[model samples]
Target: MLQGWGIWALGGVQRIGRAHIFLAHVLLGLPGLLLRLRLLVREMYVVGVLSMLLIAISGLFVGMVLALQGHNVLSEFDAEQSLGVLVAASLVRELGPVVTALLFSGRAGSALTAEIGLMKATEQLSGMEMMAVDPIKRVVAPRFFAGLLSMPLLAALFSMVGVLGGYFVGVGLLGVDEGAFWAQMQAKIDFEEDIINGIIKSLVFGLIVTWIAVFEGYDAVPTAEGVSRATTRSVVYSAFAVLGSDFVLTALMLRGE
Candidate 1:
């Protein structure tokens, strides 16, 4: 049992080391990305634009549900008018970034892992080496930067659409005072405290998800089964990382408050 534990621990350490090295190689390619703006734009389209519908639809339903539930609870306290603040604050401060990251992981992140893993499996990545081209720069870095840049924007869009959905439910359907709802939300939501912190969280989550996805692909065994496993690991690992980091980030952000 002890020997088995030792082996597991050593394997974990080695994986971590490889991830760090992979991250370094990916970062080294970032400066050159500016010169190849087309690559970045193409990836942004794949990772961001393609994912918007999912984010927007999810945000809408989530906000509608929150409005319905919050109205029930707040009504007991005679605070139904505060429904807007509740939905806005909940979505903007927490759900916006967290949920967006989770969705991105399942959608774009998994796709990235599968795509890269297949490249490796088919020896396409190896082919780049034959031409003296850096696969990390030519392939991995654009997607990495695209995911990073797209995350915050997607989070913001989620929050915005969510707020609109909440408005539809709270004001149009539930008959919470329209003016009061918007007023309370505006009065309570701070630009720097709520919005900026949420953006930061999304950025961190983006970095984590994209890093794991690319690394898993790059390190995958060059076989069909290996690529499949790597894609699955990408989603699972990204989800865990996003949740864990969210708790730490939330604690730190709320410490002052």
Candidate 2:
């Protein structure tokens, strides 16, 4: 049993390695991505704009919850006014990118996988290949680039809205001092250290999520059952990858600092 389990684990690792190489091939078509700017923009609209409402709603609620809980803690120490710093730091340094990536995995990532999987099931990708067309260049590259570009913007929007929600809860409802809230946040939240790192996290998440999504769709068995399975796997795998990578990145980014 132990040897069989070990063999299974090694096989899984090899499959993952192969998937990474496949993604690298897709990435090599970066110039083709630029050449297909129109398609890329369309995908951006689908992946970014269509997903904004949910991101906004989730961000607001998360911020509000953070403020409520943070105020409870800080008030005990007579530091209620530091709510701004707490909320802003939490959102910018961690929650913003992580939550946005999770949302993207559910909304845009699953959509990409399902769309491509269905196309594969319907023989569209094969038809393109039969015409001497590179499906990766024409079909995958634009969507990949769009996801890569959209994640940071979505994370920024999420952080901004979350901050606003925190403000509403902390200052409007809880009677925390408004000026102290904003001022403390502005004073402590370094743009380079906090904001830029958050953006970097979002970008890395975008690459991982999209790569998994498209690869699952492309390699899925060309059947209805296969397409459905691939779509589910894409979201699950993307979520795990985002969370796992976030831990490693946070450790690296904060090391010796």
Candidate 3:
């Protein structure tokens, strides 16, 4: 169904399957999210630590580009001062969550699939089922909550980087006044809304990554070939889901605004 002629079929199947997985993620994440605060904390550390180099490296370039792009466009209008607000808004609402989600999808999503697929190959899940432990709650649930907790942390980190990128580009490179950057940021921004939007987007993205990974792993066939197929599918589907959801959320948010 991945072929061009089967695109519609693939979309429909993916949508239905994704919806089921999404619902599972939310329901699973709620109790797990509340009860697994300790795991959440640890997962935060792992995600933040694992992603720090990425967040910083990506963020630095992101910030530089945001400012560079803003300068080019706003300069045409002679409204260079809008750079700060533009960067702030763009990072908070859009780039922050989208970029973080893609990164998380690549890093965490593939890892989750491989780990679970390995477990399946080793019969760990069958063993768990035989032992009467709920595999979903015991295994998938923690990771689910972990993704939920990690999304905002990652997004916030990216936004910070993006904002700093703007700062360096605006002030250090462009010679914009420092106070003016902050002042413009404060003047045009609605922190509550932007923050909430960022969180909401992250939450959905977290759910998407976790669900795709788990589904692919659980469905993996036997032998190394099956594992490889599952891994490839995990990355492909997770990336597609992230981009599709980002577009959907952006459209919905824009329509509301």
Could you say which candidate leads in lDDT? 1
Position 257, candidate 2: lDDT: 65
Q: What tens digits encode model 1's per-residue C-alpha lDDT throughout 1-257?
A: 99999999999999999999989999999899999899999999999999999999999999999999999999999999899999999999999999999999999999999999999999999999999999999999999999999999999999999999999999999999999999999999999999999999999999999999999999999999999999999999999999999999999999967
Model 3: per-residue Cα lDDT over 1-257, one tens digit each: 35875998887788678758645754665675576677666655655568767876787788889899998999899888888998999888888888888887777778778877888888998899999966766676666667667778888888998898889989899987788888989888776678888889988987787778877777778567898899898889888988998999988887887
N/CA/C clash count, model 2: 0
Kindly provide the TM-score of model 1 when superposed on the true structure, using C-alpha atoms: 0.98
Q: For each predicted model, how many residue pairs clash, with residues at least 3 apart or on different chains? A: 0, 0, 1
- Clashing pairs for predicted structure model 1, backbone only: none
Residue-wise C-alpha lDDT for candidate 2, range 1-257, written one tens digit per residue: 99999999998898799888878878888887777688889989988999999999999999999999999999999999899999999999999999999999999999999998898999999999999998888888888888999999999999999999999999999999989999999999998889889999999999999999998998888999999999999999999999999999999889936
TM-score to true structure, per model: 0.98, 0.96, 0.85
The lDDT of each candidate is 0.96, 0.93, 0.80
lDDT of 3 at 249: 90
Q: Model 2 compared with the native: what TM-score?
A: 0.96
TM-score ranking, best first = 1, 2, 3
